[model samples]
Target: MMKQKEAALEFAKLASDWEWRLNNLYYITDKEGRVIKFQMNTAQRELFKNMHLRNIILKARQLGFTTFIMIFMLDACLFRKNTRCGVIAHNQDDAKRLFREKAKFAYDLLPDFLKQMVGAKVDRAGELVFSNGSSLTVGTSFRGGTFRYLHISEFAKICCKYPDRAQEIVTGAFEAVSKDNVIFIESTAEGRTGYFYQYCMDSLNKHRAGMKLTALDWKFHFFPWHMDKAYTLDDPIIVPQRVHDYFEDLALKVGSNFTSTQRRWYAKKEETLGEKIKQEYPSTPEEAFEQSIEGTFYQRQFEDLYRHRRITKVPHSPASCVHTIWDLGVNDSTAIWFVQLVGAQWQVIDYYENEGEGLAFYKDVLDKKKIDLGYTYGTHLGPHDLEVREFSTGKTRKEMAQGLGLFFEVAPKLPVMDGIEAVRGLLPSVMFDQERTADGVAKLQQYRKDWDDKHGVWKDRPCHDHTSHAADSFRYFAICAEWLRDGYSSVVTLPATHQQQIPTGAWT
Candidate 1:
């Protein structure tokens, strides 16, 4: 009877202590499908120690954060009276699976005494209602109820694949929680735009600045794949010298070291993942989103550029004449690039893009740049559609541009794929000014084919987003490069599409 009382006292103490209960009382299915006592891994423990009211986590694939969060919310519901928790997955199937596998499975494995003590009244369809007034719910979105804790899983995928749904969650579900309540937004990166990326960047900036976080402020957390001990391999593999150099540089950047076994694991994984390895198993936050997006037209070429360190601080050489390439957009954005040909290399010195601007504005911009940089102007190349007349002004844009003292040479009209090919061909010889052409480089990195949701495949045409203008301007530059390579005249005269010819003296 004394031993039974002692055991009862120990059980009560464990029940009162949340962390002890998490470690000893709860049961979770391991990755290999074996039920075991819940023990926090390095990543989970680190994240839990620093969690604030609002948090954003950027992580490599399969760090078990989703499972951790599910268990955490379940624990919160069990221990705190009247507490309500919500788990949001990227889709309906994921919601059901997470709830069943993480929450329900663990709950079913609880001791009979604890189960009776908690008195679970409702356990059906992604929800568990306890007799003590706490409840847990899982869904793609929840807008009606107030929640003490909220977790959004795979938010980056939602932002990339379902932008409208992502906005709805931002407006509806996010508003359901109060400012002081706990909210976790976690995901592997998907390109470099959307709410998840923005939140991660903002929180990371605040973290880097060493600013104190408030109830409303988000705390940033990053979990790299190397942090997991299970990521190493027993079998050895040869690491290429270039890859070894990349790892060395990454170590200096992130202040962490990797063993040869880990490097071998990465090397083997890269064989299957190729360019996607960085995105999937990133060592740093910058590398997570810097990789080319899936279906990108210039992924291979951009990888080469990064490998060769071609995207650096390329200085503008006054020895060569600078050329301007443009993609004029009607009712959209106008993108421009300043390039110089020195020997066989193409130096992309500068880039500029603006919306709702006219020829006069661009001309003023060009003139100001010319005076500031002291550049000797060469040919100004534009796409074939530059000659299209607008309703606002009957004259073609080329004529309007010529009127502003900026003459343009029209590039040959080619298929989109052919232009993409031209850009790929020229990328090998191109050197970009990192600071001046940062936005253009980002556009190039993210430029990819449109995804067809219904068909579940990438469409042949490129997705025309903010990136398209810059990419289009570069395509025009590539076409002009081909023309110069073929020994075409560098002079820009009256456009062939212009209705009237200018005097010979206008050439100057």
Candidate 2:
């Protein structure tokens, strides 16, 4: 009985401590006079209150992301005293709304005793002039200034629309702030090649490197659509069926973006309006990418590829010899990829890609690498245009390859659709040996479609110029191998209706 009483007292003391902490923490109230407690989920709450570094809040919608930051800013101004907080949004309207809403809410939530201490009045414009000379200014990228606490909302969109201005804000204004300051940049995923995405990648790298960045300094937050516990597959029965059908068709057509988690989430949200709304605001990186306007390569196939670390080099094998593919470029680049075939798996082993170079220079690289000339392969149709054009040495591409002591086999020519289909079919089946073909594998993974808006189709535009020669060569080899497997005596010809119509200007 004594032990039970002691345990009860301990529990009571712990509860009292928590209550004290909660009471001291700041809260924002809505216009209804009810105190709005920032209730975060496991991830959201953990991230919000984290004092480690400036926070990066990658949030799905309705996660109270903006609200949380606003409260944090308010706490800084009220408690820290003399703190200069700046909120920058994609445009003036966003900045104004965020500042106005947050300031008004916070001002209303202030206790009467604290309200009496309001030294400066809240400007109708949403700028709060505090008594301690600290001020909070809400401005767009156009209005530049130094700040102790800088909040950047929808930074990815801002950077895309105005790259120069975004750079100025990050480098000129935000960087000038003291190290002790907080700069929170939060946004969803843009394409993988944007400034915001690059920054996030760099921050992640820095984090992995054990660099200590404040929550505001270098943070990446991703709130995918699946985190909402209220979401359930039993709810929106039709949504699951529709989503599944869509994914099935999509996978058959373009071959990506239907992750297991995504399917589950889609099903869960189908029944409930809230869950559906949350789907529009993905909470995790994978969800965001899958639902992104450009779509993503995060499905089972991509997952398997990533897991196997397929984008690495292949080890040298005596039985496995290297074969090359060449996409000859004069104005663009001369690309050559070295690949090794081991049983059914193909590995990109090495590469030599460049432009405007003499045949001797290329020959030297080939000799240095000791690549066997017999295994080299190139387009069967040849660099139709480039092959006919005379270089300064007056040698054609065939002559150039010969002069470089490189043996070249003509790659089989197929209809454009056939080539594309071949690549698509081969990608999932190809097992890359990373040790020998790191560069080549990277190119393959990054070989993405050029989204055509007019036709609403994804067209393959050859990419990886720096390392694509080898990839092109490998594709040629794969095409030939596939041809042999199918028992085709010659290149399989598609019907005239399936032939790709090359644009008139494409040659130039």
Candidate 3:
């Protein structure tokens, strides 16, 4: 009798399990008979299960990122009592809608018995009140406060309204969570220099160092643009003829739809709707950022420069002798560029840059690099600063270089406009020797001007720093070249001439 009762109980439990699975709406079939399941790729799955304190999700669009995070937040609120979770969006309307939708969906799907655990009544303001004193609040980044679990949506956009608010909210609110607190910062790429972008990059660096960085506790998800299911990169028969034809047309107009490696897979999957849908949604953070943000640097000149290879160093000869361009610094990094003049072109050969070094150390490095002492160059400012009291050894910067057996030339103080124009003129004429001057070439390519739109003028301030050493050196060289051509003249003056008049010894 006891054995029979146990068997009967086991049979009932099995039946209950099957019934529960069948009743769950998330597992149920849609109108078309497709299961409404959370379809996550391998990467997305890892991100979902991640429990790092500081996490960042650099993801593409339409991979159910918002939904996944919503589920995670909900689980936290449900399981942890006396804990507050805050979801902040770019605006209030979005915050309200997203919170309400997810909460209602989760609420409606709960089993009857589980419904008893729902502590708080849903309010019009989109706040969820729980029985265990735990609550979930949805608010805009514009309104700042403390939160244990803080979710920032579209942080890149948040900067548009409250430029400093993003930083404030993260540091001020998330910092207070203190114990087992989790802060999630997820967004596609914005501009290269924005606060969100910087944060993401900083976190990435910390992660690489194997440090326990709160920022590294986050995950990054990136989906490629071509992963959309509705798009076909290749295949004429299995893929819809229209989508295939459209994709072909798009490829012709916008170049290849398939990245080099994906060409074959894209061709095979073209018949399937998965790639097309992914393309529409974008599976990579880079792809999403590219699609969502127009006029971004992602596909612009910045990308080109970033992808360009650095020039390498070559053997030194009298014909390709290296010259050093010096930009002296005290606390900041003093930069020196190794360069060679090839006909009209200047090829940067190498670079030595560092901060807070003694004059003797710099001299040793110069000696080691075999820098041409005669070719050492700097702006006229070098001579002036060489006269100032040194922070390290009470010697001027000029004296320091001289102590290293380097004879520094005080190239004339070319006006900022002249220096800018000279560098611009030299760029086209310059041909970088990739092997011999890797660092110097990098500095040249990275050199940029500070433009002022409001004043309609370029700033006269010197941009010479660690990266600008080579560029400043080239400018000084250019100025010296101009001076030498004009009989060592202090300033260049244009001679006025009549168009019709033909002077003797002057070729037309």
Top-lDDT structure, candidate number: 1
Per-prediction TM-score, please?
A: 0.64, 0.48, 0.44
Better of 1 and 3 by TM-score: 1
TM-score of 2: 0.48
Q: Model 3 over residues 1-508: C-alpha lDDT tens digits?
A: 9998997687457535522322232222233645364344454466655547767766544455566566566656655677778777777788877776665466556555445765465545667767776677777752344466778887766743354566666566666565567777766554343456556666666656776644434543344445444333344334334445645666775466644334444435433433222323444433434432332111233344334532223444455445555666667666665656556555555556666886677767876665543334322223224556578688766666666665565654545456655555544444444433444543454454443433333344544434455556566655455443433354432212211222222210
Error of 1 at 158 (Å): 0.8
RMSD of 2: 14.3
Candidate 3, residue 376: how far the Cα is off, in Å: 43
lDDT of 1 by residue, 406-486 (tens): 888787666777778778878988999866776677677788898664333568999888889999989877755845544
Which one wins on TM-score?
Answer: 1
Q: Which pairs clash in the backbone of model 1?
A: none
lDDT of each: 0.82, 0.56, 0.53
Q: 284-307 in candidate 2: lDDT tens per residue?
A: 454454443232222344456656
